[model samples]
Target: MSFSFLPTTNSTTTTTTSTVRMLPTRRSESHSPASRCKSAGHSSSSLSNGFIHSIPTSAASSTQRVNHRQGSLDQLIFKLLTGKPKCLAKVLGGSGVLNTSKNSVAIQTTPIVERDVVSSLQNCSEVRYGANSKPRITNITFSTVTSATGLPTVPAEPNKARSSSYWKTEASHSQSSNNNDTHGTSVDLLRKLSVSRKESGSHVDTVVTTIDGQRYDTKELDSDPDFQEVAEWAFPIFQISRKYPKTVLSRLTYNIFQQAELFRIFKVSPLKFFNFFHSLEKGYWEIPYHNRIHAADVLHGCYYLSVHPVRPQFGVAKSPDSLLPAPQTPAASIMSQMSTLELMALFTAAAMHDYDHPGRTNAFLVQVEDKKAILYNDRSVLENHHAAESWKLLCRTENHFIENLDPAEMKRFRYLVLEYILATDLKQHFEIIMTFNDRIPDMDLQVESDRLLVGKLLIKMADINSPTKPYGLHRQWTDRICEEFYEQGDDERKRGLTITPYMDRGDAQVAKLQDSFIAHVVSPLAQAMNESGLLPILPGLENSELWINMNHNHRKWKEEIESTYEPTTTCNGGSVNGVIEEESASTSDSPDPRRDSPSLDSELSQ
Candidate 1:
């Protein structure tokens, strides 16, 4: 990125200037508006800031001059930067003389008049601003430029806090060879809080130290170098989060964004993030399941699918990344398909997908005709509520993390968040699996629709991914979710409503439920993800490791549960093997899991 601000008449002058350039605007989601900026000449022109905006494709070099204010060369250049916000990072980087120290820019004012400046900006096709107009702007050394409330627009590389030894082949694509240990840059945003604990030098936690303390208190995540090193390859968050449970969701969410370099790319202030995620934590009901822990787990799963699909094969091989697929391979390609903005959207949606859940499933909400069900018209009620409430939190000034995005990017981000979160509705579960199975063979990364379709699947899979985790972790999730379901059943019994299947307190089998859920929902999604090449095949393994994990959990239920507990009716309501449903309720009022899911195939095709 380079900027050349001076014009043709003063070509002989030896005064040096930076080369200014703009990359093509990326509006893969919300089709960028037809125009990036209004006409160059405005009814009122003031000289205040830096460089001229890259004229939009529609605004050709039309030199129609309008009313303008006469000002010095500094004001004109300054005005171009201040006035033309659409120029974004490219134009700012090109201006070699950025006054980075204070609010003002330190531009060297030449005798170039405002008329010529405006003319040059309008007729930009031919005008050359400096000695080397198209030179790279390497000297533009500012890592982040941010407004008080806005996130950083200039994105830095992802966090490289961990050692590079265990990273797969994907690192080579974004990382430079010169930098040996180029882990994503670690900016511990937790230190920015004005809390007294840090000032007193007490060896304290990032925010709070207890379960009863403020959940919204923004905390430092993984300041310990030892933990970070292990985080690179040890176990997933399903285990780690349980060990350090204090503000775990908030910290885990921060780490995900930190690793992705969302803070640098979006220019989000660390302090502001504390408010956003803590609010999310506060919003999560402290239930048996669908709590903050579950949200954090899903976030971890989604990010891994997008960025690090191939886990390094530890100890088994001399080189940890040897089993890693090549960058061009289909399995590896899915890892790199998502853009940073899309990553931001995916992760944000993941973190808040189940926000404000009331320990009830969508089926229960609709069965009871709960207010939320009415609000969403009884379709995907809980999911709609989660997305809607998360947006409300973002709407608050403290949690305005993405305020810096342009209208088009902002709109695109909202669309992504809504679609990703909404996909969590169980009604869309089989529909998404159907789509994945239908499209997996020829999935095209170049197509925006295809990319988003995969993103939705990723979030949905993440929501239900506990079954594919380590057996102990998977069992813990099963216990928690069953407890929540039973609690809802208790409430249903009190209200005199016929309890849905799997909610029967007396006869409901936890082990049977786990086995049935795995066989019906979890197994199919895992198969689709594996066949799609999103989950890479492990070295010398026929199926993905996740597939094996699910199978192991399924087998454990049959071995330990059915033999131990009573199993009168099968899970599928069939007489033989168990299914997802626990009882065979013949009443019309009881919600049918099969009928609840309306077809999404017609909607997806559109």
Candidate 2:
């Protein structure tokens, strides 16, 4: 329990160790798998308000050989999903369970928390040997997701011919699990079939929603000239196309790449980009605010201020036909000053800054002693996870956008991405502001340090651009984020931990919280960037629009706080535009209407 971290052994056996602290948990059963060490009472750190780490033994070794036969991936996958798709949820995006029942199995998941995977390869076989050949066997060392189950750290044995018996067993397992499914629903992934009478050749998993009588789908979305127009601006219209978050994100990012010529300039493969985005989208948990939709919004915000050829006026376009991206040249904007590689890094960092967010703040994670916080040693835990995960995700062959870049350029690109993302941490908010405060007055873009600071500023702007948006747009974001905060508060209360300010469901109000956040946090950053002479940098920012929207939002919240609002339940979208005050307990004791919303753990490994 108090093992000193040993350096990697240069001998045949590898011993890579990291210093991980034990966690303090409210649950009596905190000896759960991911955090479970050999003994609970093994260290003084375990008794403190620290995170629970499994203390991955530096001694574990692997002696398995390589297996690169085709479809080996599929065979192992079949073995896993032979039951309900529980493993899919763990691998694809989440690990938390919101609702479980007696009849259902208390799900056990493969917790990918530690990274010290014991590799069998004795030499430098981690290099990609066949980057251009078939049987595309490359030796890339990675942390094992399977070994947590106490299985040997090994790849699939050479995919050899299997008998009919194997297929028969797999089929039998799948059939039995289907019969045991709750109302025919997969335990992890719920399924919904079409209740409508529309005749279709194949079942398409698409939900079509119409707003203001404007029907939105693939076909109509393309024709709705305004859809693309909205994508060009800082404040994008996500509510109008919220259902297709992944699709919308892909399209907007694709278009932005085209406009900036990132694909051409970086020699990025479109197919590879598509694969990367798909994986990235799947990794996003369906949380209230940090979901895929939020990713698209940030992408819009980042591109609009940092790379758009033209910055449109601070007004919403009534119709697609009416709103054209302003024809103004990039002369006044920072877009003209940036290199294409920098633009790619910025766009990528934007899309992935909150990759796999667990809907809880880093403070919450540290308080709960979540493994990620312990692994990161409680220092910018979430930001560090985001940077590490984003890089790891991008380095996958299918998502390797920088593969075409020379080694130096690729390293530079990675540095920029990591820097931009790490700067999004709210813990460093004052530091970033202070640094910008010193530099913005007479910042010289010609200097590398100054440009790096600007990149950080741009991402920070995008991360908190919600309050600076139009009232309706801003209101929607507030409700969603407040719901997320409220969820964290509920967890904290249940665990008997101190709830963060403006997070408690019984105490937090949208108006009050928003007013405080905007005044103390949003305004200072916006003002600093505006002085940096960046292109009305964040749209909710320039031409007085930023100040106008910010003040309007603040005043609206203040007025609401002064008056009484009808009580509504949590996560209900309350009155559609504003957060409903939780009804006082003295009011009728009708059963609470709040339902369990999903908040899956993204870092069983953030």
Winning model by TM-score: 1
Candidate 2: which pairs clash?
22-51, 23-51, 23-52, 112-605, 113-605, 226-320, 540-546, 603-606
| lDDT, residue 29, candidate 1 | 19
Query: What are the lDDT figures for the candidates, one per model?
Result: 0.54, 0.51
Best by lDDT: 1
| TM-score (C-alpha) between model 2 and the true structure | 0.53
lDDT of 1 by residue, 1-606 (tens): 223232211155432222223222221211223211112321111122123333211111246321123333333333454343433221221113322211112322111112223344445443233332222111111125433214344333232222222122222111133322321121111111112212211123345322233433333354643236323312455556667564667777777776666664454555556668777878998788888888888887786667654432111223456877444442353445566667788988998998999987666676778899899897778888999998998888756767656554676678889989988876566777787666655665554567788888788778888877766677677888778878888898999988766677787767766666666666667666765566755455555556666665566677666688666745552311112221112111211223211232122113
Lowest lDDT block of 10, candidate 2:
113-122
Q: What is the TM-score of each candidate against the true structure?
A: 0.61, 0.53
Q: Which stretches of model 2 miss by more than 4 angstroms?
A: 1-227, 230-236, 308-331, 535-542, 564-606
Residue 137, candidate 2: alpha-carbon lDDT? 16
How well does candidate 2 score on lDDT at residue 265? 42
